[model samples]
Target: MKKNDWFLAAGIVIAAAVILLLQIFGSVQNGLTVTVSVDGSLYGTYSLSEDRQVEINDTNRIVIENGSVVMEWADCPDQLCVNHRSISRDGESIICLPNRVVVSIEGTDGKNEENSLDGIAG
Candidate 1:
């Protein structure tokens, strides 16, 4: 390849790397709680300061430890949520589409929480 082409390619790679880094570092914040929803309805919220395991509708189990929450078990066929990484930052979530369950990290200080529904109606 030409020198100018190589430089352009390097510039693109650098820009991509910078954007990735910003996304990784920018979204991280100390979340205060973990919220769980089932089938688009509000299930419950648990404190992150204390570690524990939560069972949602007997279909999914989540373990909160070390200020991070992870899906420890799920009865769904794919088990994608069970293998998801632990989330401690606000806005991070593990969604189980098959089970219609969503587990998300949230902060109560009024910054991380935005436009969230206060209740769900059938």
Candidate 2:
């Protein structure tokens, strides 16, 4: 309604746009490695730059190609992990709760300390 109110609205919009752009570009970094874990223990870590398929404990299989990783197969009845999308950005992951398998993307130093909070409870 007022000139100051209009300026305040424009400033808020600009700030929101900048924050959104930062979030998009910041999370777009290509991960350097794919880390696999089973039952809360370290299974293996593979380079994301290399394309290959990995079998985990005969219960799950994953494919890494073109800088992205995807769960190719899983014995779990729900098939949630198998149906999940590929992950290529740092801290992205595909988790198989039935098999207790976690496939995550890590940065160049093979660590994702920043976005480690996978979930939160109210």
Candidate 3:
């Protein structure tokens, strides 16, 4: 209602918007590799820059192309993983619950990948 109050409110709004934009842009950048895991075991890691198809334990197929990874095929019942969109951003993932498979993007810095925790485990 007061002039100072309006200025403070506008400043807060601008600050919040800047932080949100930074987070959005930061998450999608510097993701150079994709890591695949099956049944709680490490399966393989692939580069996003390279085009290839990875078959996971004869149950799921992962396709990497054009800086993105997608589940090309799967033997799981629901097919939810197959329908999911490709992941190219850091922290993005395509998980197949039935087959216990997870595919996630890994950033180049390695700090994000090394110290990350799996919340589902706890």
Candidate 4:
């Protein structure tokens, strides 16, 4: 291989490493709130800093603790939402399709609010 080729390869590897590191570190901010929606309606927003339990219209149950939120129970048959892992990142979510319940994290940058009502619009 030529000297220029080796330099080009090294530059590409460095660029890729920088991109990967940014991605890993950029999304580390803790979520500020948990927004719950049911049946295309805004149900409630709870702060992750406080530990609490939320009942979503008697259809889904949510638990927030230690800066994370999880679906503790759901009346839906599939129970996919209930099985989802707790999320504390800005864009993470646990959605129950059968019951139309969605639990998601909201970040300070405020991107989620713009798309939060998408389900209702369509």
Worst 10 residues of 2 by lDDT: 113-122
| lDDT scores in order | 0.80, 0.81, 0.82, 0.79
lDDT (10s digit) by residue, model 4, range 1-122:
89999999999998778665554444436547888988889899998889999998889899999998999999999989888988887657899999988898876555544443332232
Q: List the residue pairs that clash in candidate 3.
A: none
What digit string (tens of lDDT, one per residue) describes model 1 on residues 6-112? 99999999877866565454453554788999989999999987889999988999999999999999999999998898888766789999999999887766643
Compose the digit string of candidate 2's lDDT tens values, residues 38-107.
9999999999999999999999999999989999999999999999989887767899999999998776
Q: Give the TM-scores of the predictions, in the order they appear.
A: 0.71, 0.70, 0.71, 0.67
Angstrom error at residue 43, model 2:
0.1
Listed per candidate, the RMSD to the true structure in angstroms reads 6.6, 6.4, 6.7, 7.8
- Kindly indicate the candidate among 1 and 4 with the higher lDDT: 1
- What TM-score does candidate 4 reach? 0.67
RMSD of 1: 6.6
lDDT of 3 by residue, 1-122 (tens): 79999999999998778665554554536547898998889898888989999999899999999999999999999999999999887777899999999998877675655433332221
The per-residue C-alpha lDDT of model 4 at residue 79 equals 86
- Tell me how far the alpha carbon of residue 46 in candidate 3 is from the true structure, in angstroms, after superposition: 0.6
lDDT of 3: 0.82
Q: Is candidate 1 or candidate 4 better by TM-score?
A: 1
Candidate 4 lDDT trough over 10 residues, lowest sum:
113-122
Candidate 3 lDDT at 81 equals 99
Q: Considering lDDT, where higher is better, how would the candidates rank from best to worst?
A: 3, 2, 1, 4
lDDT of 1: 0.80
What's model 2's overall lDDT? 0.81
